[model samples]
Target: MIPSWQRSSQGVPRAEDEIASLKTQLSSISDLQSTRIGEAVAAARDEMAHGLAGRVSMVAELLTEIGGKPENSMLNLAEIQANLEFIGLLRGPEPPDLPTEIEALCERRRLIYDARDVFGDLFDRVREVLEIPEVSVTVVGTVVHDDEVDDETDEEL
Candidate 1:
């Protein structure tokens, strides 16, 4: 049997090369998506804190830590976003052991799953306190800066 190089047309790249290129492009797309989603969530959190719950000490505390990992990672949105992006970088080779990033992969998965429970519980609590109708997480990204959560709060009042 002829080798792939001998049988194939001259100058055409191999399947492996194309796969590697596509993987990098995919990773880049994931990074951008993670960043956009993270920022949108953070902005909504900010609006909820400063706009409607200005006097609620508990909500105010959540706001202060939502943008960062807080001393104890109470509502670690920042870590969740970083984990989301890190998940994108886990592209493995065909049957790849991927030892270099395996430790990181494990750690991030654990953190993200833990954050899910904390985030969901906190989010529900916030909604209960704000007394707002159900809102989709996806819808928040569509809101431009000017049309913030506060806009709806203002209209309600």
Candidate 2:
């Protein structure tokens, strides 16, 4: 067996080296977490883009159907309301006290408002994560508006 002092001398350096390696690993993990958070923010922005596209498509379809034939506008409104429900923006059936068509349209508007609120909150969160000095979140807001315009143009075409 090795002498105790020699054994200790040999082990001390190895243990110190191991600790240093562990510290390096921890620092790497911290970097990875930061990267992941950035990726999540980008992903949230993409999701918001897709959601906005979907909402715009539903709105355009509703408008087109309404313009094409006034008599069947109620059906189009119901379809728009259904799309809103599919997206988790609206809840429950149309109230019996209100006319079905008007109620459906009202619900669609309410759902749009809710979706706007959700996107706004998400934008704020992503902005918080970015937190780049001197960078304004207004640019992000502008991009979102431009995306909406593109979607609207596509619908018009």
Candidate 3:
């Protein structure tokens, strides 16, 4: 027979403590996974950006070639190129909203984490001051097994 400290009133391991410990471990693992996934995404984006190099030059050369055609000589290549460059300049390299949106989301996440810490501290203080006895809980679950196995042909028929 196991000691009372190691087991709950129902003679099973204390489930709440085990569950809380598991949650903390899983949270750490998930945070690491999230960071790895984000890094992978950023790497993929960088690879894609590198692969797309020279595409703009290709477009510019094609446009210049088209303008050089005798029948299209009247078409102003300089003006067209200037317009394209102007459009590119107007975009101003990098979206203005993305950084601000990221900042706002980060701020919200910080607030949420701060609130969680505050609540956890409050709960700890209340429990400590009241000298409450922690309740021991045990989780029990069941699994069902099917003994009869049928072939795929039998199911089809």
Best by TM-score: 2
Score residue 67 of candidate 1 by CA lDDT. 50
Give the C-alpha miss distance for residue 118 in model 1, angstroms.
Answer: 1.9
TM-score of each: 0.30, 0.34, 0.32
Residue 128's lDDT in candidate 3: 50
| Cα shift from native, residue 118, model 2 (Å) | 30
Worst 10 residues of 2 by lDDT: 65-74
**What's model 3's lDDT at 94?**
61
lDDT of 3 at 32: 99
Better of 2 and 3 by lDDT: 2
Residue 147 displacement in candidate 1 (angstroms): 16
Stronger candidate by lDDT (1 vs 2): 1
Candidate 1 vs. true structure, TM-score:
0.30
Off by over 4 Å in 3: 1-14, 58-67, 70-157
lDDT of each: 0.67, 0.63, 0.60
